[model samples]
Target: MTIKELETRTGMTRANIRFYENEGLIAPSRLPNGYRDYSERDVHKLLKIKLLRRLQISLSDIKAIVRGNRLLDEVLEVQLQTLQQAQEDMSLAASVCETMLADHVAFSELNAMQYLMTIETGARERRSDYFEVKGDELPQVHQPWRRFFARFFDMMLYSSLWSASMMLFFNQNPSLQSDASSIIEGFIVLMIMLFVEPVWLHFFGTTPGKALLGLKVESDDGGRLTYGQGVARTWGIIGKGLGYNIPFYNLYRIWKSYRMCSDLETLPWDEDIAYTLKDSKKYRYVTYIGGIALLIFMLYTATAMKLLPPNRGDLTVADFAENYNYYLKYFQMDSDQYYLDDNGQWAEQEQNGSTVYLGIGFSERPVFTYEVVNGTLVAVGFETHIVGEERWVGSNDQYMVLSGLAFANGQKTVGLYSKLSQELVNAIDSHTFESFEFSQDGIQMRADVTYAGYNDFDSGVLIPMDGASSFTYDLLYEIRSNNE
Candidate 1:
């Protein structure tokens, strides 16, 4: 059947059917004539969409309700509760209105009735039946620590095996540098360490860690965790382990926290829908719709790219800078200002008589700042931040990328400084170094050491490095500094 037939059968207009098609409520293939060919599935979907529309559900909300993974019984219970609530609200409103009109109605009582009506109208309509576990649902019956350790052993064993394999493979390919290979190896290991356990549990119901400790992650209501819930939990675990726990990446968590707080302050009462089990089908439908939409989009993109003129792989930074707004929006980067405040212009904000000026970089994740202390080099601070910049290939086309150092007492002069690695000890070429870099990786100082401090080797206190390593601990340096 064509879309017309579907419309006729469903008593929906052709435009409405087409609108549903565009919304991904139903997917119909194109016929040879370039017209939509609707199937039985399309008819059924239209019926469902119509029913859901009558219930005053948004498309996205309908999608979630239809695509949910909750059990059938759970879904029915949630639906029953929602209907009951709606009935009670309607009854309450009717009772209040009758009381106001029939008996003595005070001005204050009218305001209360209006407020109650507003709440009843604005209350969350929960169509999806699924609840996140509370803290008490911690499932402490199984020793989490023991399970973690046992899983750690398994992870270690696999890690060693993978490491050995990598070594052998890279050894055969002598061209691969230790630095590059290590980065790649580290990434792969991190991926495995992060996802392998959760994936294993997702597939086999228990990871080696959980199995060894005789632990199982069950739903709070004693049901198996829905696939979506399991995946969400897995992602949560992955974020905590990789994004928050690592050194440089740990700053991301702080940034996230700040952003979350800011958002709460700005829009504390943003719209939200509570989902219960009955909405599982809606959720499932939405998942299917999303998948179908994505697949169609991918196909369209591939086809369009193939048919159209190939995108110019060449565009210089200067060229992109002409359309800075376009580039900024595309990459979601914010414009950052870099000032030359050499005469301690911004000294009022200096900490401990040390002034720092920060310049936002191309990579928004890292804020680059040079710290000047008491007419000498102090540190360069790279506060790991997320500016939502897109990673581009080749040299930065629009901006000059430089790590500049300026002296506090001397004439307003700024010079470029080479980035120092965490492990590199000796200076590659002798240049008048001024500042140190402070990032999550490590703290690096200038080549020429100025300050002296005692080194307490054993204690975790701040030890003044006299001559411990090539790069002194006091040396302030940052990686990937950008030119304004």
Candidate 2:
């Protein structure tokens, strides 16, 4: 029979059935798929447990009887005596209440000391141990909210560290796309916390967040947890308390844990563990908030720095290329425009047909070439043949290409405007097509636009749009430092 069928037959809740099983009162066999396979014996056993529980039998006694350590009748006899003693106490309390009502006793004038003395005397005469409560069994304090926030703080700290490390060392950014990559990233962070949290608990008895909240997780003996105990407890919290942080199941587990804590019941993870809380000043909360805020700030700062181009100070050719590539990648620009060859020289991306940029068609992609003087980049330039099969040199397409070249030369996206002269900027903005050159602050800029064509052959055949009859053109743009 299934558990649901068992629930129906025995008239017991799933929780009750599971609790009894956990207490070793009933042991069900497991099926191939890891589900419990209950039998008729389990149904009968659960019914017996229900009846015994109704008779106020404790689970410990029931477990001993189920295990054959004690006879059922013997346990029943002890329970019956305990119940008879409880009945006597209730009768004595009821008699006192009846007497008070018969005398019409008012609240303010009630003889409390007289009633207590009477009850105490009755209990002594009956030789009952019910009123002799043990002081050592007092309930321990529970701080569910504090514990939850402390764990949350620790998780956030771990996530931030992971993000910063990936961005700074690995040059990898968190994925903005909604995909399994995000879930995988979260899993990695959880794994990191799993291993790291145990070390903190073993050595310090608390994590950073727990320290801030004045909370400590100790062994039952009130000492720091051993490494093995720490691992077990942390794993228990991840599995039973947090449901391994799986989406909807995590919420259910969290609610269940909260209820257990609120009811002052020992959490499954803390079964043989102890939690101690010191009197914390109110400023601890402030510090915790500040710590979380600082982590978030650092995470964002790292992301921004990773996305930005390299610094502008006297850069080598490789450094300049790195900055340029960073801009292209960050903006998701077309990456097929250029590439580095085997000798580290910029080479145009090869294609079967012409490529277009800023509405202007070209026979080849523009390639960037740089001159390095004394290990510092001093000049950069590129030239490409523009297809004129259906376009003219003075058309708007030419103006658009010129404008794009001006923007590219200024390195506008990277905020490196010092590379372009103001005179060149104004001329380009004014759509001045004639060859012009200007220098400012040791930086020189020039542009050369020509209308021409050339015959190109490949495999003894004329390449299309490469003959002099075709009205093709070429554009050359360059920027150089006079210091070179």
Candidate 3:
């Protein structure tokens, strides 16, 4: 169709139609010959434009309304307001014209008055049509669990009540210097509730905070959370936290956190909603509070523990010393070289691939003894005597304990332990027997031991001993002596 045809249909001049195109109100095609090619769609648009113009809608608003960008209800509401203004302008014009006609004003003056009244009345009827909705009309929904958690957890935990509780717990006990271990335990528990719980609830069946916040967990498929889902989310947190908090393990956690967050964002929501922290509502306040609270709690715990009293009555100074010597004698082990298989099992690097054993056990008070079976000694139990420091170490496949002792000669002793075995006896015998530390229940001693050879004597792995060789291997293990 030609612009002339649109002009004939809408009664708008061709120049006006061209003007509308220049204003970006409409777009008409052009033929190969450069002639304007207006389609039926263009005719419809022009008809709509003429209708809106009759209603006094501005070109910009008419464009938006025609594009279906503005909601129908919204446009109708503006039209209603415009109608009301037009009615008011008509009434005002009738009154002004009546006064001019009755005053017998000069014909020229009356014409001028009539002209001015027409302009003023028309202006009065022209309402400012807004393309946006009124603020009050906007709708809001309940905050998501992630968003809520990002808000309240920090405020509650870091509150005066929580801090005071920690301060009181610490002040009552001396010799309980806040160490890495104690701080970690408290933090792990708190995080399991605050950070981990919400995520777990979303991935699992329910989390306490989510429950309180009326949130529900679901798989990407929208299926209910399975037991396995719960465990994965729960333990995933434990594993991730350990990786982040533990020495070396934490580096892996940090890297995993970043990768997981990035990957989660890109995951197809239609396929899955296993969102990471990044998916939680975009609010930063809750996350900031949680992070700050964690830091404060850690520092406060450490400072409070330092000010607390030692757990002195668990064992006397003398008895502690005797038990210390006994453990130092047996639990230590010597090894030439250790091999860690791809499966994560630790065995002697020899062709036989024998497993090493380093076991330690506690006897009566003043008689602490240990045996090294499998696994290296990481820490002694005596170090934990300060209270809240008696921590355990473990790999995915196994766990270990560190025992404590104070020697009879006023020297402190601590020992490392595992299951009982000849391999452990041999490792103990290979030590150089150098220096030692005291503990309430045992003593810790490190010495150099030469590896005689590898052997398997009912032990998964054994390192043979050549009569008391010296190559100091630091031993760490924990003992929970019933004697205490």
lDDT of each: 0.42, 0.70, 0.44
Q: Pick the candidate with the highest lDDT.
A: 2
Q: What are the per-residue Cα lDDT tens digits for candidate 1 across 1-484? A: 9767787889999889878777776788889989878899888878887886776555766666566744435544666677776776566557667767876767766557565654455453433222223543233332223433544554454455455454343222212336766556556665665555546545655555444444455555554555565555555644643352455684565355345434432111111111112122344445444544554454443332222111112222222222222222223232342222332121122436554655434332333354443433343333322122222212111121222111111111211122222122223122222233332122223332232333333332234344433322222234322211
TM-score of candidate 3 versus the correct structure, residues matched by position: 0.24
Index of the highest-TM-score prediction = 2
Candidate 3 lDDT, tens digit per residue, 353-459? Answer: 66663222221111123332233222322211111112221110011211222221222222232112223233343421222222343333332222223232433
Error of model 3, residue 100, in angstroms: 85
How many angstroms is residue 200 displaced in model 1 relative to the true structure, after the best TM-score fit? 51
lDDT of 2 by residue, 38-114 (tens): 99999998999899889989888888888889999899898888889999988998998898789898899988888
Clashes of each: 36, 0, 63
Looking at model 2, the pairs that clash are none
User: Candidate 3: misplaced stretches above 4 Å?
Assistant: 1-176, 183-217, 220-228, 241-244, 263-273, 276-484
Better of 2 and 3 by lDDT: 2
Residue 269 Cα positional deviation in candidate 3, in Å, after optimal superposition: 16
Candidate 1 TM-score over all chains jointly: 0.27
Error of model 2, residue 357, in angstroms:
18
